[model samples]
Structures are given as C-alpha cells and as structure tokens.
Target: MNTETFINQNWHDANQQYLSAALAVVRGALESYTTSLPHPPELTAQAAARQQAVQQAAAAMPAPSALENLCRLFELSGFERDLLLLCAGMELNGDFARLCAIAQGDAQKAYPTLSLALAALAYPHWDAIAPNAALRRWRLIQVGEAHTLTLSPLRLDERILHYLVGIQYLDERLAGIIEPVPQLGELVPSHAALAQKVTAVWNQTKTTTLPIVQLCGNESSSKRAIASQICQIQKMHLWVMPAQVIPLLPSELDNLIRLWTRETILSKSALIIDCDELDINDAARLNAIAHFIERTNGYIFINSRERMRLPQRLLVSFDIQQPTAKEQSAVWQAALSDIAPQLNGQVKILVEQFNLSPATIHAACAEAAGQLAQSQNNNLTDILWDACRIQARPRLDELAQWIEPVANWEDLVLPETQKQILRDIAAHVRQRSTVYNTWGFAGKSARGLGISALFAGASGTGKTLAAEVLANQLRLDLYRIDLSSVVSKYIGETEKNLRRVFDAAEQGGVILLFDEADALFGKRSEVKDARDRYANIEVSYLLQRMESYPGLALLTTNLKSAIDTAFLRRIRFVVQFPFPDAAQRAEIWRRIFPPNTPIADLDVVKLARLNVAGGNIRNIALNAAFLAADAGEAVQMKHVLRAAQTEYSKLEKPLTEAEIGNWS
Candidate 1:
C-alpha cells in the first residue's frame, strides 16, 4: 500500500535485527576497552568480566531467521551465513568507535584488514577474508580492500543474488530500481513457459547450468522482451547479449564477454541472446554464437527467423511466434488503454493488416498517441496509418504499383490466338509453385527456371492491365522494378542491385514487372571492347536470374524487335499486345465506366470509332466524366466526342472523317 510497507515486507527483519545486535555489542566493547581484553582476563578478573560482558551482549541477539533459510537453500557454511547476519546487524550497532578500532587493527599493520571481521565474537575462515572470496556472493554485501577495508551496504536484486542475500543489510532502494534498459517485449509466452519447464528439469537433474533458448520471429524486440520477462519471472537479472553493446572488432567482443561473464556470475544473473537479426544469411553465425551461450547457468535466449541447428550437447531450445490474434488484441488493448476513445477502431485495423510483435504494438500505440497530441485529434486512425507505414516501409522501393482491377480476362478483346496465349500465360503463373517444383522444372538448380513473360504490343495494348489482373488473382504484391535503379553504369553493380531485390523479396514472393525492358534487354553489341563485353554479361545475368527465380517475372517491351533474339529464346511466354481494332475499341468503351456513372445514353458503338487503345480509352472516359460532373450534366455523346478530341490531340493523331462520322 505504501512505500515503507512495501519496503518492510520485501526486505524482512533479518537486516534490521542483524544491525541492532551488532551495534549493541560494539557499544559494550567500547565501554570495556580501558580494561582486560582477550589477553589474560583471568588475572584482572574485573577487566575480563567487562570484555566477556560485551561478547555476551552481542551473543544475546540471534541471527535473523532469513539467514538460516539462505544457508539451508544454498547449503552455505554456517559461518558465512553468520558473517552475513553480523554485517547486516552491525550497521545499526551503536559500536562505531570499537568497530573503527578493529578496522584499524594494530595498523602499524594492514589497516584495511579482514581480521576485524574474523576477530569479532564469531569464527571466520582466513581464506574467506579476501575481497574476491566467494563468501561475498550475496551481492548485497560489498567489501572492498582498498587503502583500507570498506564495507558497502548490501543491495537487493531480483536476480539469484537477492535469493542469496536474504535479509542482510541489502539496500531497499537498490532492489526496487531497474536500470531501465530498453526492451522490445517481455520474454515471449512460450519462452517463459519453456523456461519454467527447464528450471524444473534442472531441479530434477540437479543440473548446474542452462542452455540458450532459440526462438524464431521477424522482430527482435519481441524476443528481447520475452527474454526480459523470463529473467523477471525467474527472479534473474536479465542482460541482452553484450556483443551488441561491445564494438565489432575481434578482441572487443571477447573482452566484453569476459566482463559480462564475470559480472553475471558475480551477480548470479542469466543472459538472453536476442537474435532478432537472424536470417537465412546468418544461420552459420547464429549457430556459432549459440555454441558459446551453452556454458552458463546464466540462461541465453536466441530468437531467430528459422530453426538453427547446433550440437545438442547441453543446449535446449524452443520456438516462439509473435502472439496470436487474441493475444495481440490483449496487447493492443493494454498498450492503447490510455487513449481508448481514439484507439477504438484503430487497434482492429492494425490487427487485421499487420502481424506485429507485442513490443511493436506497444511502440506503435505510444507513437500514435504522441502524434495525435501534435495533430490535436481524438481519433487514432491517422496515427494508425503512420504506424502501419513505418512497419511496411523497410521492404525496399522498387516502383510502387497500383492495381484497380475492374475488368478480367473476359473483358479483354485481343485476337483469338493472342487471347488463348494470354490465358495460357495466366494459367502457367497460377500453377507455377505446384507445377514447377512438382514437374522438376526448378530441380537442376534455382538458376534460370523462373517463369519470364514478354508483353510486346503497342504502348497501350493492356500490357500493364494484364500484369495487374494476374497479380490480383495470385494475391501477391506487385512491384514495378525500376530498371534505372537496377541497371548500373559501374561494372557489376547492375547484377548486385538485382540480387538485392530478388533476395529481399524471396519470402514475399512478389511479381516483378520490369517495365520498358527494351532499355536493358537489348541486343548485345559486338564485343568491340571491355564495355561491350560487360554489357553482354549484364544481359546474360538477367536471363539466368529470370530463369532461376522461383516466382513470376514479367518484362513488357513495346518493341519486341528491340529485345535480343537470344533473350526471347529463353522466355517462357511472349504475348503480343496488338493495336486495338474497331471491335476491340468497342469492347474497351463498353467496360470503361462503372454501372454507377450517370450517362445520358452514350453509344459504345459510336464511341469506339475513335481508334484509341485500352489505356487511352480509360483515360478519355475519366476526363469526360470530370468535365460532365463539373458542368452538372450527365455524360452524353457530346462529352465522349470532346474527350476523344482532346485524347487524340495528345496522342498527336487526327480523328479521321470516317472515325468521327455523325459523332454529334
């Protein structure tokens, strides 16, 4: 209820009782200091009585019961437990003068002497008198042998150190504080549960050490958060792997590890290897690090993308994903609790669109609230979009594609043969994953086996539209890979950029449309010099990647002749997007607008006479609708004719008398 009450309950009576008794003895010692001491108290019986009285005064108070528990649990020597109690109690002891004398200890000799502690009423081991002695493991009790022996008050730790410290003069303030190290989420649920299981296993087997718990996930924050939770649950001090904070140089990490190991063993804490950076590329390195984490009672947690294989010699591992939707809902609710009015629907949207880790959810929610304060809004949807964008922004920018799919294959009016070929290409792309691997198409290697299609038609023969239709059908993200970004003037940079795109998108399994392929996929000029040879090399590399890629890759070139014949030979599909005929133009007009658009009986037959391609047909209809809407009139035949006139002017083509006949 109150800080004092909490402190008293957590600290217990050991430290208090130890301090009181110690002070009482020291008080008696100073009173008797002018008399017979440990020497011959028999001859001077009165002086002997005074010395004995002080000893008896200290002995009258018993050690705190907590000390007995620590000794029993840790199997500590009776002397060490008593030594801790004496240290705790002596703090409150009114014997500063006598204790100071003991510390000065005939110091014509070593002033910072451990003998004072040993010489007190209790028996102490000479070996344990050293500063680094294992006897001081109860981290609360810090004794330093510097210019003079100094006793630091004990500090409480949630870690194993606290358990060992018991009721000594542990600092209450110290125990309550956390260093506030940054964390993602607490230990993932499965990891915490697994840790409990491991602890039980350790108990059953009496194993003295713990192995790293390897987890796989997209974000490292969740892994680290899970790890921190584990240490808290186990009452262990948690530290993220020191390698992160240490420099990258060879010896730097090693030195950090040494410092880390010493501090952990001294503090009796565990380590969590938050390997959020683990991926296919770093599998070997992940395994190597996990190898080293297996040697300590200080546990290590490895969170990675996939299962890593390491010698099972003493290691134990479990996998964890970001919490389920239900769990995420709870996390969202908890994180957004402060802004419930604003977050009511925004949380749901985030849950639907993003599979975020608990840490990410909290961060996003907090950020959303902060932004809302700046924007002065009670609604959180705006903040939600910002968070979503931040999460999605890491996937590199090839060109972003927009797919407004209003028409399907049936709406397209290509020639019968071209239509059939287009349908076949769609089918091939649809069944690619199953057919390619099952049919042993990608068996020889991942090299040069992807499905590459070339769309060779006039500028607007539905090439881009077809790419969108297929992408929508496959339910995959479509990226129009900017060739300018992919092609490099520098030697070999072209291939390097291409590899980055392919490698990053390997998991997303996106469809890449390399628009205007003629710029790069040109006929190889004769090997006139090294530049020409490099140009040929670039073409060869593209061909291999297109074939080897395990996804659909489409290259659209307006001029098929510009693409090398050799490149065409390796392409699995090449569909020509022919110029639109009268019939095709009519079909494009019929489907140009949605049924909801208000039209004043515009005839698709009359509109088709303009002889524009599908792309231009859609553009003209859009312009015409805006013009009609602004005039507060329905879109009629006159609107279509005027839009067409403007569209033809832009194309640098004149509307023929036969095409525009009887338009008004």
Candidate 2:
C-alpha cells in the first residue's frame, strides 16, 4: 500500500479504538452511579483504567482525532468536553438511555441532561451549560426545551455529531446561502501578481487580526480569480455568499454570524461577500451587511464594483483592473494556442478593440473554434472578430436600444464634405490601434483617445442616418440613447446613469449614439446654485468618459450653437448634417425605393421639388409603396403626391402648388 493509504488506515483504526474506549468509560460511569451498591472500589478502579486507555488510544493516532480538534477549536474545558460526550453518548449508544433513567431515579427521564451530567460525570461545572459557554456558543450541544436549565434535555447537534466521527462537509444550515469558488487555472501575469500581493499583505501584517481585503473593480470575474488564487496559495477553500442574502432579522443574522464563524474553523475556508449587484438604495440590507462584516470573524474578501466604506475594520483596498494590453495579447495567444501561428496580427487587433477579461476571451475563443470546426473554408480572423463582438454585446443591450445599422454610404444623402467626415470617423475607429499603440500616441497619454463626434442639424436632416452609416461602415452595433431622457433632474442621478452607460460600453463592439444632447450638453451657464455646479460636474464626468472610451461615441443635437464650445473642442469630429438640396433630395428619391418594388414612370425631378429632407423623402417613398400595394397597382405619380401630402401634414407645413405643380 502507498504511504498515504497506510497512514490513513492506521489513523482510522486508532480513532475507532479511541471512540470505543471513551464510550465504554461513559457507560461504566453511568452504571456505577446507578447501582444499589454504589461504592464498589473495583468498578471505580476499572472505570479509571478505561479512561487512561481512552487517552492512550487518542495519543496513538497519527493525526489529531476529530474530537480532539473540536475541543481545541472551541476551547472546550474539561467539564464542557465531558458534558458534550454525555450528550453524544445518548445518540451514539442505546444503553446510555437506560443508564440515564436508572441513575436519575425516574423512568420518565430517559435522556441525558445537564442535571444528569452533573450527577454522573467527573469534573462537572454549572458554567459548562451556560449560554455563552463553548458547548452552547459553538452549538456543539443543543439544550432541549424544559422547565429548568439543569434539567433541560441536552442533545448533540446533528452537524457536530457527524463532525465528531471525522466526517467533513459544509454545514447543512448554510448550504443554501453559500457556494464554493474554485481557483481558476492559469491567471494572467498581472492577476497573478495581484494574487502574490494579496498573499504578502495577509502574511506580512503583524496585527492581531487579519485585515479584510476589498477588491474594487468592474470586472467581477477577475476579482474572483484573484481571491480564489489567494485561497489556493494559503491552502484554504473559498466560498461566495451574495450580500443580498444577509438576513434582515437581528436574531437570524446573529445566528448566521456564529454559525459561519464556526464553519470557517471547521472547514478551513474563507468567504467572499459578493456585493457587485447590490442596490445601493437598500438601507436595511446595507446595514445588515455592515453588521455581518464587523462581527463575523475569519478571512474575508469583499467583491464589489466600487470600494465599500466598512468602518471599524482594517480594510486593505485594491483596485482590480482587467488584464493589460500586453497581458491580453498573451492570453489570446494562449487561448488560441493551436491557431496562434495562423493569426498573424489579428491578436493585436482584437486586444486593441475589445477590453475583455481572460475568462471572456477564452469563452469567445471557444465559440470561434466551434464555428471554425464547422466550415474549414471560412476566414479564421473574421470568425474570431465576430465571436468577440458577440461576446461583448450583452452589457450594452440592457442600457440602450440596439439599432441594427442598414444605412450604408450609398443610402445617406449628405453633402460630400459631411460624408467624408463620417468616413474619417470610421477610419479612426479602424486604425486607432496602429496610430495609438504602434505610433506611441497611447503611451504619451490616454486622454482624448476615444473617437467622439457631434452631428448637428435640424430635425430629419439625417443626423441619425449619418450615425447609422458610420456604424455600418465600421461593422459595429449602434445603440441610440436619448440624452434628454437620460438627463435626470435629481442631483447626481444623471451622472450615475451616464456612468452605467460608459462602463457597460467599455468593451468596444458598439457605437454609443446620444441623440438630442442639446439640453444636457449645452453651454455652461454661470454657477449660481448647487444645481448648476452639479450640472457642470455632470458634463465634466461625461467628457472624461468620452475621452477614455475605447470605441466611437456620437452625440446629435438640433442646434450646433447650443453645444458648449469647451465640449465641442474636446470632440474629435463635428459633422454638420445640412438639409438636402434639390439635387441631393432627388438622389435620395432615386435610391429610396428597393429594387424589388414596382414603379410606373416615377419622376425624381418632380419628387425632389417637394421641400423635405432625406428622412421625410424616405417616409414618403415608404408610404407611397404601401399605398400602391393596397391599391393593387405600381407606385405612380398620384401615389407619390398623396404620400407627400400626408408627410407635409405631419410636418405641419403647407404643400405649395409651386413645389408639386409638375407631380401630376
């Protein structure tokens, strides 16, 4: 047999012998106490010898027995130890019940109690049964319902009973609220360094209590990886309990604290209280968590998006960021190890475009591998990029409306200069990595790196269309966020909403279109009140997020002059969406109808005579199609004329005879 197996067998034998001997000693003591000739010297001598043999069996074990460890962990006194054994005896052995009834001199009292322990066991003390004593504090022994303290039926807790037999498991009471977080294999270098740093902090500290670690970051998985790594190094298990599950009732919370504290010792584990999704507005739950943190003793790590202010504790805060660009490149190479040679510069492009955690990167790679396996002729690089975009799509979906970009460059009826500017916006997004990273512009400073644009025009002047064109050109998802609605009147609420938006969009697979931003991004007035000052703060916060954002962010407004000059200066591109001239309107009319639609002698020149922008022209074309389809005929001049009248009515403008005189 192997050395480990040999030693385990010997320890099991020794433990069993020890338990058997201890049970015999208890049984003998109870019998001697209950006998009529109670003062038999030989019986007394035999019980004393059996107690010595119990001690010897325990000493012979290769490792400390479960009972010995339990006593040491709880600091159980000799009387407390004997009292616990008395309670355990009633469960483990059947004869102890009869002995207890005979000894108590009442057939009704068949169970062991504190009163019985005092009468039957050695070194008995009244304090052993006290509420604060080790026996009851650790819940090693539960006192059953009764009239008096001494007479209350004492029973070993089911969990503690299993524990005494060398069985190990999480407490059943806590099984629903907590779960184990296993260590992630092969952490990034930066994350591994963080793990080492945490270990040093825990090891090098000289304080009587270990400092609570607060890992602050937006990447929850990275923080968990670091926490799990630390536990692996220290040879301790890691468990996660969401902060929302903290009990609100005072008594239940107290019970949770005591029970978990005992569990940490028994299971050799540390807990990570996940507060990532906890709502800050919940006052009662927050207070419950604060109390839990302060009172629960053992190794603890707080996982949150931002640092939590935990007063009255030594909190060592570390901001856990996602893997750096270089680290990410290495991670990509490792995850795509088989195809690393095939991907020449694709890894660099992916690392620049997507700010992903290692876990997410691996997941994206797995998805790509699956697709590549299906089609061997597919371009590997494109498949990988598409997979990354799919993986990065989830966070932004919850915060904004996702608009699929269908308007390409041909569909947009904008001035040549404005179209070129839109193309420049797409170019910047495409080549940012080469210019920023390869040319060392990113090294100088990270400020103003995001490609931000301001599209200013009148309503229906193709501002949103231009955004959609850029989104199609760039092959990115376009999310239109109405800035007017997002701007909350409550102080700081606007900034909170904006922060959520920017943070969720940090993964660069989508373009953020903040439409109708005139009200929020307007000229900053003089700071006369607290509200005005906070309004300026909101603008500044948005400017900072835009400067650091890794993707394209476009803001549209009706009036250019309403935007603050300072805000305009920080933006990279400002495209003016001018109202379409007659020639441009004619072009919009020409391409507005799909090739599949039937047309009958459509006069683009006359349609262009109708005074409207590209947006209105497209609406008229669509409405004309529907009218023709319903009338069972091709789209003709009358259909176009009728649709133009409806569009003009919706615009609250008069359709003069001069503009549509040639339509019929």
Candidate 3:
C-alpha cells in the first residue's frame, strides 16, 4: 500500500481500539455506581492497560490519527479530549446511553452532559464546558438546551464525528460561499516563473506572518492560473471567494471569517479573493474586504487590476500578464498541431495581431477546428481569425459602440495626401511586429511606439469615414468611444473610466475612435482653482494612456486649435479632412446611388454646385431617391432640387440663387 493508504488503515485500527477502551471504563463506572457492588481491581487495571496499548500503537503509526490531529490543532486539554470522546461514544456505541442513565442514578438522564462528565470522566474540570474552552470555541461538541449549564445534554458534532473517523470534506456552512479553482494545464514560461516567485515568498515566511500575495493585472486568467499553480506546488487546496460576497453585516462577516479560518486549517487550503471585476468606487464593499483580510489568516491571494492597500499586514504584489508573442505563437502551433503544416506561416500573423492568453488561444483553435470540420474547403486563415475575434468581443461590447466597417477606400472622398496618411496608419498596424520586434525598435525604448492619429475637420467631413476605412482594410473591429459616457464630473472618475476601456481593449485586434475629441482634449486651463488643476490632470492622463496603448487610437475634432498642443506633439499622424470642394462633392454625387437604383435626368455637375460637404451630398441623394419612389417615377432634377432645399434647412442655411442656379 502507499503511504496514505497505510496511514489511513493504521488510524482506523487505533481509533477503534481507543473507543473500545474508553467505553470499558464508562461501563465499569456504571456497574460500580448502580449495582452497589465493588468495582473489580483487575477491571480497572485492564482498562488502564488497554488505554496504554492504544497510545503506543498510535505513536508508532506513520501519521497521526484524525482524533490526534484535531486535539493538536485545537490545543485541547486532557479533560476536553476525554469529554469529546465520551460524547462520541454515545453515538458510536448505542449501549453507552443506557450506561449513562444507570451511572447518573436517573432513568431520564440518558445522554452525556456536563454534570455526568464532571462526575464520571477522570481528571475532569468545571471549566472544560465553559463557552471559551476548546470544546465550545471550536464547535467540536454541541451542548443542547437545559435549565443549568452543567445539566445541558452534550453531543459530538456530526461533522466532527465523521472527521474523527478519517472522513474529511469542506464544512457545509461554506458550501456556496467558497469554490475550488479548476486546475489548468502547464503554464507558459513567464507565468511559471511568477508562480515560483510567489511560492518562494510564501515559503520563506512563517504561517502566522505570511504576506498576502496580491496578483495585479488586467489578465485575470493568468493571475488565477499562477495562484492555482503555486498552491499545487505547496500541496494545498485553493478556493475562490468573490469580493462582493464579503458580508456587510458585522455578525455575518465575523461568522464567515471564523468558519473560513477553521476550514483552511482542516483542509490545508489557500484562498483567492477575486476583486478583478469589483468597482473601486464602492467604499463600503472595499472596507468590508479590508476587515475580512485583517481578521482571517492563512495562505491568501487577491486577484485585482490594481494593488490594494492594507496598512495592517504585509502585502507582496506581482503583475500578471499574458504570455509573450513567441510563447503565444508556440501555443498556437501546438493547439493546431494536427494541421499546422497547412497554415503556411499564418501562425505568425495570429500572434502579431491578437494578444491572447494560452487558454483563449486553445479555445479559439478548438472553435476554428470545429468550423473547419463542417466544411472541407473553407479558407483556414479567415476561419481562425473570425474565431479569435468572437472570443475577444464579449467584454468590449459593454464598453464602446461596435461599428461594422463597411466603407472601403473607394467610398471615402479625401484628398490624396490625407488618403495616403490613412493608408500609412493601416500599414503601421500591419507591420508593427516587424518594426518593433524583428528590427529591434522595442529594445530601445517603450515610449512613442503606439500608432495614434488626429483627424481634424468640420462635423460633416469624412473623419469617421476614414476610421471605418482603416478598420475595413486592417480586418479589425472599430469602436466609437462616446465621450459623454467616459467623462465624469467627479474628480478622478474620468481616468478610472478610461483605464477600464483601454484595459478591456488590451487584446489589440480593435480600433478605438474618440469622436469630438475637443471636449476632453481641449487646452489645459491655468490653475486658478483646484478644479482647473484636476481638469489638467485628466487631460494628461488621457495623453499618457493613448501614447502607451498597443492598438490604434483615432481622435476626431472640428477645431484643430482647440485641442491641447501636448496631445498634438504625441500623435504620430495628423490628417486634415478639410471641407470637400466642388470636385470632391461631384465625385461623391457620382457614386451616391447604387447601380440598382433607378435614376433619370440627374445633373451631377449642377448637384455638385450646391457648395456642401460629402455627407450632405449623400443625404440629398438618398432623400431624392425616396421622393421619386413615392411619386412612382425615376429620380430627376425636380426631386434633387426639392431634397436640396430640405437638406439646407436642416443645416440652418439658406440656398442662395448662385449655388443652385438653373438646376432645372
């Protein structure tokens, strides 16, 4: 047998011997007290010999028995230990109840009680049954209701009874509140190193003064994996408790701390309090978390996006990140091992585009494999890319508006200079891995590597259109960041909101378009008041995050001069989407209607003379099509003229004779 099996068998044999010997003593006491007969001297000597034999056998076992472990862990005294055994005998051996009634000299008192233990058990003390003693404090035995403390009927707790017999499990009181973290496969090299470092920090310290190992980062899976790996190395169980579940009521919170502390001792376990999704603005919940951590002691890990402050204890933090690009590429190759030969260097493209954890990469590969199985001839590149995009979508959906990129380069009407800049933006995103990694740009410095652009023009110009075109060319998701939702009136709230957006977008296969940037990116005001200073701080924070962001961040503003000069200096590209002149407007009018739409007598040159931007021109053409359909005729000059009037009125401008003369 293995060591565990051997130890368990020895414990069982020793426990049976101990219980039998104790019961013989109880029977002897009953016989001498009830029958008015002399207790035999040899009987007493035989009980003592049996007790000594069981103690020697227990000492010879490889591991301590369950009863011994409990006594040692709880620091139970001699009286408390025997008192627990006396109550357990009533359940384990049915005859002990009748003997208890006989020994007490009353038929009604058939259960073990404090009064019976004081009179029957050897070396008993009155304080053994006190509320603060080991038996009552650790809840090893339950005392039933009675008129007096000494008369209360005592019974061994059901959990404790099972535990004494070598059966172990988590306490039922912690069933829903605490759950085990699932063990994952082998970690990447970097993450494995982190796990080792954490193990070293914990192993170097004593159990009572162990520092709280806080894993801080946006990659929650990596944090959890490291924690679980460390526990496995340390030979302990790891459970997760959400920060929100820390109770607000003091009584309930104290109960939870006591139960959890006891469980850690019993199961040799660690705890990971997950605070990754918690809102830092919630002061009440944060305070409760502090209280819970301060009260409980054991192997504790906190998973959060930022390091939490706790002044009362020592805390060590490790920033957990996703695997490196090379490691991720290796993971992708391994995940697609069956068909990796057919990829033709496409794995490199995946690693360069999407920053994913190993777990996510495996999931994406599995999903792609499922799709490839359903159809034999599907493009493997598209299938794999789509799977990755779907996996990274759920979190970003709650943060920004996902704009489907349908506009192509042919649709946008910018000048050649601005158009080239937009194309350059796409090229930067595509070749970033080559320039930064292979060419050693990343070795120099980490700053100014992000691809950020500024699109300054009027409202109706094609700034948003340019962002869509780039997203389409690059095959990435485009999200429009609504400034109203991001900016806050409260101090420091804007930075928190922005941090969440960037952190959620860290996977790097998406575009962030901040529309109407002048609102938040305006010039920093002079510090005449505290509000002014804080406002400047918010502006500086935005600039810092934008510069450090991995993916593309595009900002559009109507007033170029209104934006802070510092922001302009940090941006890599600035494309001016000036108001479309008549030539560009004519081009927009030419391609406004699809070939499927019926049209007649549409004078393009005359329509271009309306002196409006490309956006207004498209609006007029669409409205004209609607009017012609309603009148059951092809779109003509009269339809276009009427739509132009309506468009001009919406713009709050008058259509003079010079702009649309002789349209008919």
Candidate 4:
C-alpha cells in the first residue's frame, strides 16, 4: 500500500482496536479541555456517538482503558495514572478547571496537586510502585512552581503516582508473550552454564519478565553475551544502562519507565540491561538501577561482578566464567578450521596464550583472515600468531607488573614464624569455599569476610613480591594499584575511583596491592575541620570496601603504626618484614643474578657485608651486571664494589670501612 494509505490504515486499525483505558485517560483529558475552549465544543450527537463507539471498543478490549493499558505497559496504575492524566490534561490546556472537571465525582476531593497526590496517590500496599513516595520524592513532581502543580515536559507520566492507590499487584503473564532474546553465538562455558540456568528458571516459572540475575566474574563480555543471548532468545532489545545517566528524580525514572514501555510495546521487544559495565561505584545510582530493574516488565539480565542486592526483590543469581579447555578447543577448531592446515604449532600455542570466549576467538580468527587477505599471501600462521599476540596485548602499562610466575610458597624468604601466618591466610582463602558456605559463615555477614592483608616493611622488602606470590598461588591476576592514580584530592572522586577499580576487577578476584598505602590510609585524625572530616571519611570508605569486597585486597606500607588502629583491627593478616641480617643478605645476593647473567667467582660472605635490604641488593646486582655486560666480562667482586659505591651515594649514606672494608 502507499505510505499515506498504509499510515491511514494503521491509525484506523489502532483507533478501532487500541482504545484501552490508557486512551480513556487521554480522552478524559481532551474531554476536560474541550469544555473550556473558546471555540464551540465537539460534543454534539455525532461526538457522543463516537465517544460511545470508543467506550464500546475499550470495554470490548480484554485489557483496561487505553490509558490504563499504557500504565500497565509501563508498570504504572491507579493514583500514578490519575496524577499523570491530571498533569497531561493540564499540559494540553493549562487550567486547573479542566482537571477538576475530569475527576468529576472521583473521590480525589481536590483537583490536581502535590498535597492531594501525597494523600491519595501514594499507598503502602504498592511498595514496589511507590517505594519513594511524595515526601521522599519531592523532586519528581515539582510542587507549586510559581503557585501551580508542575507542568514541565514529563520524562514519565506524572500520573503513575496518583493512579497507584488501591491497585492490586499484577504478575507478568508469559503465555502469548513475544520478546526478543539476542543471539550471542558462543561465550565462555561458565557463562553458558549461567545462561542455561537462567533459561531453566524462565521456563520453570512460565514467566516472561525475568527476575534479576547477576553474572559475577572478571569476564565482562561473558556476562554481556549471556544478556545478549537472553535478549535474542526472548526477542528483546539490548539497552545497556548508562552509569551516570539514570535519573535521581523519581519523575525522570518514571519517564524512563514509560519510554522503555512504549518502545517494548511498539517494537514487541524485551530489554537486556548491560549493567555490568555501568558505574557501580555510586551506591546511590547502583541501588537506584537495581530497584528500576525490579519494576520493569521485560526480561532483565544485570551484568556485574559483585553480588548486588535488589532492595526487597529476590533474584535467581548466576555466576559466569570462561569456557573449559574442551570448549576452548572446540572454539579454536571451529574458528580456525579454514586455515588450520596452514598453521603449524602456532594454532595450539595461540589457544594457550589467550583466555577468550568462542566469540572472541572467532573475532581473532576473522581479524587474522582479514589481515592475511590484505597481504595476498597464504602464510596463515603469521596471521594467527599476530592475532594471538594482539589479543594478549597487556591491559596495564609498566605502572603495574603482572608476573605469571614459576615459583611457589617455597620461593618466598620470610622467616619460619611469618611463613606459617602466610600459609594460614592461604588456608583461609583455600578452604573458605567449605567454611563460608557449609559452616554458615556466608550467612553471618559479608563484612570482614574478604581476604585482606597488611604487609609492613621498608621499601623493596618483597611486599609487592609477596602479593604477586599470593596471586600466583591463588591462580588470579595481581593488580598493583598505583597510589598516585587512586588517591584523589577531590571529594567523592576518591570513592568514584575506588568504585571503578573494584567494579573493573569484579570479573575476577584480582589481588589489589595498594603499595605505599600510607598516603591514603593514615591514622584517622580528630575532625577539627572539614578537611580532617573528609580525610577520615576517605579512610573509613576504604575500610568499608575492604571489608565488603569479595576479592583479595593487600596494603603495603613502611610504617604500620601510621595506619589507624581501628583500620588495622579489620585486616585479616599482617606480615612484618624486618631488615635482613648479614646471612640473609648473602642468600639475597646469591639469588639476585638471573640464570642467563654471567657472574665471576665472588666472595658471597663479603657481598653480604654490604648491609642493605633485599631491594638494595637487587639494585646493586643489576647495576653491576650491566657494568660487566658493557666490559664483556663476568660480574665479579670489583663490579659489585663499584655498584655498592653508587648505591650508597644514591642513599646518601657514607660507606664505612666496617661494611665495605674488603670491597675492592
């Protein structure tokens, strides 16, 4: 049909069949305004006849009025709808008389107002709807802005609050429901397992609108893909909720709800909330979103690494992970089959180099194929290797070193007593699975449950190294926090920064080693002024996060006494590193040289007399090795002595004959 004819027919069909209570609200509004017009009203016999036809169509509807249907579509009803109609009608014609005429005998007593809305629109029965009532939500509908109810352009209907009174809660009906669930070709197996569980719950309940499901892990795409997959299967649109954009004003949230509802109904699509990437650092915003999801009609899949609680709503939870080895192998073969013969050992090695999803692997292979195609060459192995290397491009700069290690607990040089403490912390983390879950500790409190440690020592005494060791032992990544990057001078910025760190690392339990933590975690001073209060606040903030975070957090400092005693009380483990004795320094000097470094015979006992920490010893050893390499000679006692002189000069310490007496 012609566009004009098609459009006319569409509107015609809508008029004949879509005259729901939602429409009645609009009609009532129009009717209220029609009476006040200077022009002759359109309420003749013909208009009456038409209104009767509209009412017949509305009654014939299996649903409520067009107005009520709109409310239902957006999860609003009763007082909220009435409040919306009042504002909407008032908007069409800025007259309170129009609103008063529409509510005619409706027991709302007065017409449209903030006070009236609070008294009648809000009800305790519908906690989910009016969780934030008028008293709590003054910003939603502006009261008497210049002596009149707010008539600002609405983000959502101002009527939902008014229409929600005495309304019964409605369960989402799944039968005959159509939704869009996106096709996420393949993801890591752990995510697949979680998605499978979500599908089962959806099917089991026979519900179209899903309960909140969180995919907690370090893998971002894994959780996102599950949401996409759910959307594809359910025939829904994927709207990744923005971090800072969610409205704090109740009116704006209501408006968003309307917008989403209109889009869902208009397109017959579901919504996939990509909240995993959203700013979870703002507790207010995060909490607001969690609440928003509960009130939406379409299926909602929230992607976050942390366990988020949805106020009063209960969600069927799931955790996502990368695919298993067998799954990864299948993905590699599928993605690289076209060029498998051309790649020799590179394909197998590439698989081990990357920890990625089937989709990511396919993307890598496609990239390789594209690059090879451009080259006009059949050397596919080079392309695959390039792709593999590209995928593993280090996420952090030298600002943090991620050591994939070969050493274990035996490699650490702490004393015997300290070693047991280190092992005990490991034991807590290792057996926490059984103890926390089976022994009822999980239910007690999330506070003070995370594995946190305070490594007290001078610089270069292996505080960072110990963190790396623990991370390697636990099979997790180590994120060495650059204190310069995290400690913010601005208010709320510190929390925002910390939130980003925690949120980003949520996908996996990474060891966050806050080196030189003294800059941020100093003793909480008495609040004599605003700056002092804010400083204490920052420390208290970190303390709360350290207690609640599910991952491992480590703090390193030279002066443990500088830390607040209260803060120290919450930490699970404290490791002290005393200055190494002469014998211990000998061991450090012996091990400082790498296997590849050429070293001439040197008196280990004499080198031990340098009187330096492990850090200094390593620096001296490295400088001496560089000196020897330049001279094309093996590192010997003379090179060590020369390096020690430079090290002492840098430290501003005069070399004493007692220490460096036999240096040369």
What's the CA RMSD for each of the models?
11.1, 2.5, 3.5, 13.6
Count of backbone clashes for each model? 21, 0, 0, 52
Clashes of 2: 0
lDDT of 4: 0.64
TM-score versus the correct structure, for each prediction: 0.53, 0.93, 0.89, 0.51
Best by TM-score: 2
lDDT (C-alpha, whole model) for all candidates = 0.62, 0.87, 0.86, 0.64
lDDT of 3 by residue, 314-381 (tens): 89998888899988988898889885567788899988889998888988998998998897757888
Q: Which stretches of candidate 3 lie over 4 Å from their true place?
A: 1-62, 86-111, 153-155, 339-342, 593-612, 616-650, 654-664
Best lDDT goes to which candidate? 2
What's model 2's lDDT at 340?
Answer: 51
RMSD of 3: 3.5
Worst 10 residues of 4 by lDDT: 166-175
For candidate 2, lDDT tens digit of each residue in 316-414? 999998889999999898889885567778898788889999988988999988998897757877888888888887464445788888988888888
lDDT of 4 by residue, 1-664 (tens): 8998776555444533533333344445445443555534554544455557666765564434445445555555456655664454444434444445454444443345444334333341333224355321422233433343332122223433222221221112221222334466765566666666777777677556656666676566566788777665555566555435667778777756655554455344545455554654578787668657766766566666566677765577776666765687678877777856444556554444345666667777888888876887666765765565455333544234455544566456667877787778767766764576568797998777777999999987778777777866765567777767677787776776676676555433356788888888989998899888888888888888888766678899999989889999999999998788888788877777878988888888989988888888888999999899998999998898889999999999987898877656
| Residue 547 C-alpha lDDT in model 2 | 94
Q: Higher-lDDT candidate among 1 and 3?
A: 3
**Candidate 1 residue-wise lDDT, 53-138, digit = tens:** 54554354344334444555445564555455445444434344345445444423322135444554345676554545545433
Q: Give the C-alpha lDDT of model 2.
A: 0.87
